[model samples]
Target: MKRSTSNQEVKKLNRNRVFRYVNSREETSMPEISAALSISGPTVLKIVNELKEEKLIREVGEFESTGGRKAKAIAAVRDVKYAIGLDITKNHVGIVYTDLSGKALKHERVRKPFKYTQTYLHEVAAIVRRFVEESRIPKKRILGMGISVPAIIDVQRDYITNSHALGIYDVPCEELTACMPYPCELLNDANAAAITESNRSRTCSNLVYLFLSNTVGGAIIFGNETGIVRTAQEKDRGSVYMYKGNNWRSGEFGHMVIHPEGKRCYCGKIGCLDAYCSALRLADQTDGDLERFFREMEAGNQDLKKIWNEYLKDLAIAVDNLRMCFDCEIVLGGYVGSSMEPYIQEFRNLVAEKDIFENSGDYVYVCQYQQEASALGAAIFQIEKFIDTI
Candidate 1:
């Protein structure tokens, strides 16, 4: 029985590997998939035929050959399945949809102020239904939907333990999303954004994603692990997992105290990183326009310049602390991150000044997906579940 179960697992893994390889590329041949995945030709052919029958892959055309008959190019049927992600924030609701390719096909942000009431939840459901209809994707094609919110999630019980952003507490997940017409799940906004960044690259397995939006948050991703549970580090590249802590409140970087008696935070705490380093620190100075703040600062506004300087100093402290704890790449994400290209070098210098291990700040970088990242990541999370089954 043990051997039978192990064999089943191995075969499943091989099929998953082949599909993943085909899905990741624009076009690939059977020979290339077999060689790259180190699978026998016969087994690769069997899996390819199985996937083809499932309508998950199709032959695009024939590849130009170096020899005999040209190899047939197989491509993933990306539209075979779809998923939706909803990002519920204090003032806006972001909606995004993705296919099996795990890329956001369409996204929209609506200006709907959040209220902790049953009416608000109903409205959220209404919007989701309208979004799906407008997207023209059949509801049956969507595998699942993920809702991203700025809150501490209890994955075991499936509820929001605390959320300062919406001023809610002990809210059941069903209470927040029960009105939606599809399968629903909850994801921490920062963690969802980190998932978006993770999908952007296959090489980076470990990273500390710092979300620098209105309310700062973070997510830690570990790569080269055997599975979801922590185990002996695998030498070969393997699955990546998020460290959600024992209580599922792992990446609360915003609350980390950077000073003892500094500014007060909305969470009724003094010297919190969010108090000084959040995107609001700069955006508030420009009537809540983050882009205008950067524009004016670069346009030689001395007042904004001084504020920007202080913001970077506080940010450097938090980033350095994260580096010390995780010792991995630090990805700056969120609203402010979109406009960070002009000032990344300057910010890196500040972080480098505090580094004791590395001389250069090469590990720090801006995120790839800037807009609606949390929403997109939430959608991709659902896509991952379907891929795993394959």
Candidate 2:
């Protein structure tokens, strides 16, 4: 019985390995998979046949023959499985449908103020159902759904511990999941963006992602996975961290006190990073129009440019502090980060002025996905789970 169990486990591992290899490559032959994974040709052929029978993979074409007979190539059926992602923020709700490869097949956005009321929950459910129905993909094909929010999540309890942006706390997961048909998961908005970025590229393994939207948030990536960095004191922390003692708020970087006697934040704090770095702060400079603010700055509006320069100065201080603590690449993301692409060089220069060691722009990078990252990342979380189960 022991030997039988071991054999079964080995077979399952090899099957998953072959499936992953084929999914990663554009197209591959049985011989190629065998060589890459160091599995025997016969075993590779058997797994390939099994995957084909399961409709997970299909023969795409035949590889060119160097000599003798040509080899048949196989590729993963990307649409065989799907997942849904939803991002809920203070001002908008974004929805996305993604395949196994994390490609967004369909997406929709609606403007609505977030509320923890039952009416809001029902509205969210309606939007998700509408998106699924319009996608034209069979419901069963969608493995699960992931919900992203700008708040601290207690994964063990499946609850939102606290979210200053939404002004809600201790909300049960069922409040949102009960309205949906598929299985649902709750994730931090910044963490979701990091997951999406990690799935998009494997180039940088260790890094920090700063989410600068209406509320400032962040995540740390170590060895190609999201992780938490421990700090001795709350004052000496970044945007995200594990709570120590009775403290429920740990990684809230936006709430970190930057100016001991600066502007007041919505969290009833003065001189916080959020007060200086959030997109809402920028919009306030131009009568609540961020676009107009940037437009004026671009047109040589000295007053607006001066306001931007001050904002950059404060931002540089916060970014430099984080860089010194983490000693890894920093990724700027969210609505504000996407817009900063045009002025990335300028921002880098400001950061360089504050850094004593590394003055190069190589340490900082703009995110690949702009506004869609959080929603797409949420969907990707579900897709990853589905893949693991398979």
Best by TM-score: 1
Tell me the whole-model lDDT of each prediction, alpha carbons only.
Answer: 0.89, 0.80
Record all residue pairs in model 2 with backbone atoms less than 3 Å apart, i.e. clashing.
239-251, 239-253, 240-251, 241-251
Find the 10 residues in a row with the least total lDDT in model 1: 227-236
Question: Candidate 1 has which clashing residue pairs, if any?
Answer: none
- Model 1 segments beyond 4 Å from truth? 1-5, 225-238
Candidate 1 root-mean-square deviation in Å: 2.4
Query: In model 2, how large is the Cα lDDT of residue 266?
Result: 84
lDDT of 2 by residue, 107-192 (tens): 88899899888899888889888888887878978888999999888777778888888988898877867887688988889888
RMSD of candidates 1 onward, in order: 2.4, 5.9
Cα TM-score per model: 0.95, 0.87
Best by lDDT: 1
